[model samples]
Target: MIKTSLVLFFALLGLNLFAQERPTEDPAITYANTITVEDLTRHLTVLADDEMEGRETGQPGQYKAARYLEEIIKGYGLPGVGPEQTYSQPISFISERWQEIDFVINGSSKRHLWDYYAYPSKNADRAKVMTDEVVFLGYGIESEEYDDYGNQKLEGKTILIMDGEPKDRDGVSYVSGTEEASVWSEDISLKLKAARRHGVETVLILDPNFQRNLSSARKISLDSRMHMGFSEKPADNYSNSIYISSETAKTILGSSYGKVVKARKRIEKKGKPKSVSISVDLALTQQKKVKELLGENMLAYVEGSDPVLKDELLIVTAHYDHIGRRGNSIFNGADDNGSGTSTVLEIAQAFTLAKEAGVGPRRSVLFMLVSGEEKGLLGSEFYVNHPLFPLESTIANINVDMVGRVDEKHAADPNYIYVIGSDRLSTSLHEINEAANEKYTQLALDYTYNAEDDPNRYYYRSDHYNFAERGIPAVFYFNGTHADYHQDTDTVDKINFEKMARIGKLVFYTAWELANRDERIKVDVGVKP
Candidate 1:
């Protein structure tokens, strides 16, 4: 009897160990796999179709696209935000373009691109500004070590300042007392803030390399820009500034030009501040043509299963608007953003499925498809400023823009995606994404564009930036740019649906881990807006 009992007990123990070691499939992977190429292709076909008219913001096509997204999220049974629980968030913007600008110095009109360039100032009291006797503040450096204003009353006066700070012979900076330039030299805003502090009406920045930079500046100045119509002007706003070449500076300074140059040299050598007064009659005239338009951002919320954690939110965003058509040619931005929109839609569906299956996330997931990204990330900006949920409770944002076609850099191996702004705010967020990719997708996560000094500046170019600016951790997924970028040829046929599906699944998996985790990821690093 004892031997028989021992045999049964051993067998039972073996059975229990086997059961404990058994590997059950994760529900996240099961749902993530549902994001297939067929679904992505189906959504992309409708989004990138020629009938959409390129889906420009504030246009008919864009409105149609917003409705389509709204219908999809509503069909998935995700709850909407705002009064009446509607999916649409209306945003108004003003489109302004410079109609004409005339800068006359000493009764001689200067050419716009060749001699001078000025941006439209929305806060200007009038279209015309005339001043006599300009003040030349050397280097515009205002600090305990050096003060250029020096008790002078510069209120309502125009000031001229050089572009860069004074540097010593050994390449050391006089302001910082080191090789690295100070904020006064690196950021132009500090100088503008100083000017605004003293109630200076106008500022003229003297750029010795103005001609070399003219081409790029001219292109940006000529393009019409958009601004929020509902928001108040920023406190640091100082837009009445003109970038002038040395020739124009000479014209304004007259005989004082040589003395100004000598003063700059003396400051660089002896670390002394100099303020010079130059008498000149300057008259500036600017006219802008303004138009008002409205756009929509679609939001669908999936409430979490956990009562407490449901309050914390995870946001997934994509821009639905593309550049409008030119004449008869349609800029069907398939790879530009249709892929991203489709991905967000599919991810939303997957989460909805999870909710239906009683395995939904612990924290709420807000799926947002925004417009005006092509214009200037205006939709995200509006949402951040006017949030339905408190910004403090918002944990993170995952933004997808252009993840369809592969770029030239990844031609040899097209199975790669650029991951930008991942580690900028939260190291834990970066690790979560990396672990997700390694465990599931196995795609090459490229951080080339995440470099602080990257020339492309991809981190700041997308909607993710608006969240990152407000100290929220954000990550941007992209497939880089291809030949058909912004071209009419960026059609559905060029998109790799299989690759896009993989990327979508990656986003889904990462979001799943983020939402269901026991604790919210810490913001180890913070940024200022």
Candidate 2:
């Protein structure tokens, strides 16, 4: 009996020592592991399915997707942060489409898409303007270096101007004094501002690349566009402007067309302003249809355990919208954002599970699955403009977009993600992400798209940009674009589930550190809006 008792005691002692030596598993890692490939695949399969109708904002498929997400988050026991404690924040906007536009010069009607192109103006549903004489403003540029308006009385006058600024012999712009185009050339709105300043009622812009511009503009003009319904009407905004081809300008300018071209050349050489008056009979008419539409941004939150820190929020975002159906074909958008939405769902579940188990983060975390991302980041834009929580209290945003498939750059090595705008706002946030990836995911944190000069301009392309613009630190995780991006071919079967789960784990681990940390991540950098 003594021998048996001694043996049992020694064996128990060995087990206790082994337990002491082995470090306790971190609850963060424990919960992060729950974001498995199976869960990601399962969530993505439903979101990217054809029945969801591509999840276009304000459409039936989008509502279905929103309901599915609401159900999932509600099932996880997370509270809704939206109005009336509902999972949805209702967003109302105006959808406008141009129906018919007529331009007549000297009683001869011009073609709409061939001779000119114009977008629906918020000013009026229908407009008619008649002018017997049109002012010719060379380049329509107003600046200290060169002024096109030069003491001209343009009040209620119709003006015709050429597109782009004058470039010198060495191909340097006279306005910017560089090879790069200035705001006058880059943003047509600036030129319109110049026209509006002069009290011009109608502005005709002559495009050198009219055919190419019209072709591209035609694609978008065929589709209806949405804007905030409460915003200013078109009449309250800038003057009515129309883009016209050289042929249209020739009809309007008559003999003055050659004189206007010579004026542009003279200005390019002498760096001076030239203005002329052209006598032409013109009448313009535009008709548009505006419809009010409603969309939703699905929001749910896990309140922090600590009282003081719970007030400060961390946001995790993903856009659940895609380009809707085209005829019978559907743009499933599995990799474009279905992957991102699923990752967010899984992350939300993991956080909820952690909270239920009494290991929640110290800072509140809000999970936002937004719509209209494919529509122009409208959902996120609306959220930042009309936030449920104080924008000042929001600490950081972590956005996941397009994290499913391998791009051509990573075909040989698929274990990588593009991290954008992390170091843009906070060095601390960027370091935290790097540390999380190093310790847990170990996936290649590629910053290929993070460069300020990156031609892709991806930093400003996604939903995270809305938060970043509001001085909030943000990080965007992406798997990069594939051949199937934004196409109907972006189906669920092409997703790299293992890679997606790893990215989700990395996001969770990063969020874990950010939320539980004693101090909020400092914004050491300035935001350029």
Candidate 3:
């Protein structure tokens, strides 16, 4: 019995010593330390060069960028997801460029690109020609208090409506919010969907605001818009939408304009919907040049060491796309995303090096360079919807956008970074980030842009929003907007490489903690800070 007790005590002592001396150094930290400013500059030089042509979505520039990323990741010995044995995740896109538009009201030809403007809708094919009876629905709003189409038969009919919702006598909007317009007024998509639900085949939004300002029409003409959903074709019974001048509405109503205006005022004063029928014929003809294109999101991963935890994933993303070019000017988006992209490359390499050194993290990390982010987060949205890994297994996302330069807010204090959505879904995630920063790359981790009500809406603007929307914890690293943001002046010379490397290291450290932690970060649904 004495000999057995002595053996047990010795074994316990050995176990304690083993626990205390367990390498004392985190290999993930060692890997993160490998990320360097020189490597970041080297990658950025190639990515943001003028020859790359701004890395526009679905364009040659973006394709080249995708291929470059794929080759780099492949070189790092990272394996792709499927049988393709490549890092490219192809996404299909349909591009629409409007050529011409003709809108006629009551046999009187309306001016094109002046009195009314029609954009190439995903709902329209190569051409869309519609001749239908017009109905004037005041504001075209349907609410519990008042229904505009309560007893109205609007099937296959074109409805003309105002831009804003109703207001009380005091001029305060009745829907919600005091300073800004309600959701109904803010989102035209909501109004369009509502109009379609009421069996309205077409909608003409008459706004005095858009009439004089030809900016919207100019933008639509300048850029070819891409859409992912094909069901938007008008031939598929989708609603046709157009924005017209108030003058067009007046011309359509003619002698009944006074009565319509009176009804509008009455509705605004009474805080109710006033639906009216006007005898008018409306005709719309649009011509579009269509092109189908393919885009790709570059995805590469480092597998975890622990067999059980290898299935869990953490994603690091940056959009490698920007507006291609406008005439002679190239909007070289070096700081916009090239910085973030290069940083991702370095972080990925660091992890790869660590894995080769036989000290990989416990959970997997996916390095994604998504395209179509400039085109409304298309690639990220597609990934979330058709994810290679189950979203439930996605532990968190660290998104980097425009982290190279110091913005106006941080010009004096250049070491600061706009950290958004850290506490949005996970309290533990935020704590990990704070601790990582305190220990490693001591960045001024700014949370000013993290607020949901922030005007810039940084949280919703980046690729991380797609992950967050799917209940995954996401944090966006940003350097706020500068004068050169989305402009031709945003070139490589303007990028602050040292500051960028620091931010990159911060992200790597945060990811290191997340990937090496014993358990997944606990999601804090209530804390949105």
Q: Top TM-score: which candidate number?
A: 2
In order, the Cα lDDT scores of the candidates are 0.87, 0.87, 0.82
> Taking the tens digit of each residue's C-alpha lDDT, what string does model 3 give over 1-529?
9999999999999998996556438665667767888888888999998888999987888988888888888889888886666687887667667667677776778776778776665346435456545677888877665566677888878888888877776667767636456778876766777777877877888877874567867676557766564324554544677788776777877877887888888878777667667777676777777776568889888999989999999999998998989998888899989999999999989888878777777899999999888888988998987888889999999999989999887788898888899999988889999999998778898898887788988788899999988889999999888899999989889889889888988999898889888988877676343
Which window of 10 residues has the lowest lDDT sum in candidate 1?
230-239
Which pairs clash inside model 2?
122-234, 123-234, 123-235
lDDT for each residue of candidate 2 in 1-529, tens digit (9 for 90 to 100): 9999999999999999986555247888888988999889889999999999998888999999999998888888777675578888877677666777789999999988889988664335557889999988889999998888888899989988888898889999889989998989888877877788889988898888999889877765676756675533656566778899887888888988788788877888988888778999999987777776668889879999999999999999999999889999999999989999999999988888888877888899999999888878888999998898899999999999999999999899888999999999999999999999998889998999999999999999999999999899999998888788878999999999999998999999999999999988889998764
| Clash pairs for candidate 1 | none
Local error of candidate 1 at 181, Å? 50
Query: Model 2, 199: alpha-carbon shift in Å?
Result: 39
On the 0 to 100 scale, the lDDT of residue 292 in model 1 is 62
Residue 345 CA error for candidate 1 (Å)?
0.4
TM per prediction? 0.62, 0.63, 0.62
| lDDT (C-alpha) at residue 353 in model 1 | 88
* Alpha carbon deviation, residue 65, candidate 2 (Å): 0.9
Angstrom error of the Cα, residue 276, model 3: value is 50
